[model samples]
Target chain A: MQGTTRTPSQPTTAYQPTDRTVPTRSPDRASYDKELVHSILDEGYVCHLGFVRDGAPVVLPTLYARVGDRLYVHGSTGSRPLRMTGAADPGLPVCLTVTHVDALVLARSAFHHSINYRSVVVHGSAYDVTDPQEKRTALDALVDHVVPGRSGDSRPADKKELAATAVIRLDLDEVSAKLRTGGVNDEPEDLALPHWAGLLPLRKGYEAPIADPGLAPGTGLPGYLSAL
Target chain B: MQGTTRTPSQPTTAYQPTDRTVPTRSPDRASYDKELVHSILDEGYVCHLGFVRDGAPVVLPTLYARVGDRLYVHGSTGSRPLRMTGAADPGLPVCLTVTHVDALVLARSAFHHSINYRSVVVHGSAYDVTDPQEKRTALDALVDHVVPGRSGDSRPADKKELAATAVIRLDLDEVSAKLRTGGVNDEPEDLALPHWAGLLPLRKGYEAPIADPGLAPGTGLPGYLSAL
Candidate 1:
């Protein structure tokens, strides 16, 4: 429920096309539907954050959260990207991407082998969040993003902890989702070959909740986690 | 068996640490071990590749394979990154990263919540691979990387298929693996809190393979896939 609020100024269904969001190849696989982009972004646990450092590109994997039309990424105040955004006057340009591999498509020919995946890419300028209220909301969204309703269950961050953390915000203006689904596309001539061709679906989910050893004796498992 | 050969010039046990490979925040979590890096890279199906374009960073998810201390990424010849690398005189500077989320670490306090994960980041220049022999080997490695021993079972690429694919190579000279493992690390004072804190382990693996409907009747599932 954190990222469900919409403003009148925002696009109703699909995002507007931008130069960077358009793919140079396989344009058919790209989509600007707002629902598709949000679903892909929400399903991911971490995002690969790209930024320029010393004139060279650097990519790092970190936690992220989406709220309405904005995305939030956090780290220690001393982290490189956070520090860079704080020092820059306007903002730090960044590319944030999230991907989910659903299955492996094995074809009769090596050339046709591919993976079925869903991915979302957002290009924008990241600015450090200084407002105390927005920062707190972002932090709660980040925690809840990992596990729904987790923020209310856990102890909120104290003043000292809040000061040590840095949160950056990126508006989801230039965004697009690319996806590939379904079966293998082997050549017709190679259909009768000895190779066994098919789809190997990748399964991912939570196993069981492991309780902390130091947990209080009477603590019970939360309903939100049990439902997952 | 592909990508296992090592040259005499390569390091024995670990990779050399470069300035860009070091993490500015959690230095203790960074590693340069060669085996650790290879194991992490081999387990992933997709990588987030980052490159600078027009002074801004771009990140895309793509399939990749590792040969010895080198990584190969393939795409259509008309792809933006592939075209850019072919045009750049000294090759294109890129950051390739792979990550696996092992578990969700839930702490009694929101500040200590984190994920247990293993990730590898490689910083270097990516050059177009024009040599036919090397490109073929890289393509095989790419297939086998998805499923072990799969390259031999599939039909080899023909001349037309090879002409359509573009391959690029990046040496793993500047590489580092960062990992976060073990249980939650909540504040000692919060140990007595009522919240249930622990790790929610994520399970990922291949399910039963679904055969292609057009497959020859007698074709059986390969032993390598059965083993998985």
Candidate 2:
């Protein structure tokens, strides 16, 4: 339970949901129900992590794993954001998002073209997971997040590598998942235009697994992987 | 030539080859050459556009298209970043990136779990393309970028709809493309561990086209659509 307590002195920020200008699509698209949020986070293996450094925004595409409601991201301790967050003062406040574009909505008129997509954005004050036990658990959550049953099967991190790594966690409290899934919505006047307009759906699926050339002969591909 | 001849008052950012990052991988794993860059851009239909708004960084997923070394991102004239760039002062300085996750690398050690990906990041000042002719051309590129030959087949934008939309162009100067491909790389010591380690090669391929229920009876899936 010691690892579960928050440090009282850590500064926190209030997140006001973004204002929605389009009356039809409210700013509430800026937030989502927890169920909707966790589904999006769990389904995707990678996320685009965004943070502002030195007044300029840097977006790093990285792997992320979600455990219950908390998301864990890890990298070499030498990485900029990881190093910055691990330092004493102001921890990095990040907006981590995962998205999957489902289809291309080819509207009749050029101006109305849009894509059907599912995206979730999380807002939180992120600090490095400092406690050794918590760091080990977070790293395990990350490993199992990507390959579900593999964590217990693999050797856990040793002391030296553990010291050289950094892990940060963002709770999925303030989150928003927005989705647009439909065919083209063309303006009335443009319906007669001779353009071919319809959807070109996009999908991602796993093919047959390619075993590593270096893999040992006896170790075959596991069921969880084949299921993915 | 009317659109290409008249350059806007804003100066084009020079392409400084040295400003880019040489990825710490095999040379074939990274690219900045025009053909490689354009190929990646053309294949990706969406991008993660990041910028600092107020103080914190925001990354929004949006649709994009590429023409030569320039990328066109379209939005309603009222969108925040689009409006910010269209204002009179210096346009919004933005980082635009597109990525494709090709495979998942499952290594023996937990630390080496990674993904094989191809991504392009363009760092430049983004401005609203105000010229009517150029805006139209950019829109065309955006359309054809997603669906080949669809631009010519579709009706061009009309006067009023053009006014309600904005196209922000980010030149490919100061751009970096990084990729990770190949099987998992496990540490030599972990080879004896009794765990499975290999790549689950991820791929995106079109399924049988789901004809739009609203399509006219005579209209079937186009040859290009089926071919993909």
Candidate 3:
């Protein structure tokens, strides 16, 4: 929300629905609107990256950044997923998901208890970013994704550092955003019950930033972080 | 941490590591300690469930409850994953992960920027909970997992509700907890840079609970919620 800029022209564009993107349950909660999908993806810092390993599913939490319709994830060159996406190999299939839990829905009945959340799921093949120019931009996006204006404040990665890191790009082609908002969904019969029921909103934000012990004297908090 | 009780006798026990649980990177951050794994899992409200579908991996965020060595996930009987775990089908292989971002680690160099996080990855086979007694207990755990002491105050699910819900159990056989904590890890050459570098801690907690508009008159906020 802070560092990323949205394309105004694509506000009304929607992704074409595919069989895998359509959910079997709660189909009403799913949306293919591009703007809605981007908002959900940009607000989160980490994504659960799912890939098949040894014929079994493996999900790992990793840092990701969205640039236009493409998502980039970087790691050490030797990392399993990064290694699997080599230049010679075909793209690796991955399912990337980001979720934000907004509130805990407390209902009068145990069966009705639920969480209000927004999530986006993307199914695509990830390929290595070999172009130097694109790789550098993706790396900057990754840093700013965590904290806006951070890439400019920090030293850019040198050739050696860039060589050691691997970036994988996944296009946001087959995706869907799912959300559950609003109040409790308690049964009519249970409304009169004595239990207190409503939404317990979860708040997430930054506290006071701890300055590094070795930070240069007189260095001040950047405007972006202070705004946060 | 609030409602779930730890087994005192297993304080020093560690889960036997398997090939899948061992990470290919950051080996030092991975721990097979049972207590550490349970703590990471219990503190989170949702898990990213990864399962293979049509030979491709799919990851979804869903509510989960941990009971001793078992984790239970419930959904509508017709949900995709739930339907896949029918009585006659072989157990579904799943990789369940829970992650908590503790801080945003800002470094002097963009390449070193990282986040302080704790995560647990569990690899196992999930089977439908066919036994009525286990299903009931699992359902209560699911409710209590959201709010401690909530299951007791709320109305238990009736026969029809239980019939509509599907609960699946995954044994905590192959599990590992990975953590990244503490301060910035800036390179020595960049320590003298002017950028502010350190940890921006992320705070997560509930704000005041919003009482349901139709709450019964004179109903008070429950003790369990007040404690939270």
Model 2 TM-score, 2 decimals: 0.87
DockQ-based ranking, best first? Answer: 3, 1, 2
Model 3, A1-228: lDDT tens digits are 111222333435988889998888887777888888999999999999999988989999999999999999999998888888874377999999999999999999999899989999999999999999999999999999999888999999999999999999999999988888888888888999998999999987988999888889999989999999
- Give the C-alpha lDDT of model 2: 0.72
User: Looking at model 1 chain B, which ten-residue stretch has the lowest summed lDDT?
Assistant: B1-10
The native-contact fraction of candidate 3 is: 0.93
List, residue by residue over B11-104, the lDDT tens digit for candidate 3.
Answer: 3598987887877887777888888889998899999999999999999999999999999999999888888877437799899999999899
What's the fnat for candidate 2, on a 0 to 1 scale?
0.53
- Candidate 2 chain B worst ten-residue window by lDDT: B1-10
What TM-score, computed on C-alpha atoms, does each candidate reach?
0.95, 0.87, 0.94
Ranking by TM-score: 1, 3, 2
**Candidate 2 clash pair list:** none
Q: Is candidate 2 or candidate 3 better by DockQ?
A: 3
Instruction: Please list all clashing residue pairs in model 1, or write none if there are none.
Output: A3-A68
Candidate 1 CAPRI classification by DockQ: high
In order, what is each prediction's RMSD in angstroms?
5.7, 8.7, 5.0
- TM-score of the B chain in model 2? 0.86
lDDT scores for all predictions? 0.92, 0.72, 0.90
How does model 3 score by TM-score?
0.94
- In angstroms and one decimal each, the interface RMSD of every candidate reads 0.7, 2.3, 0.6
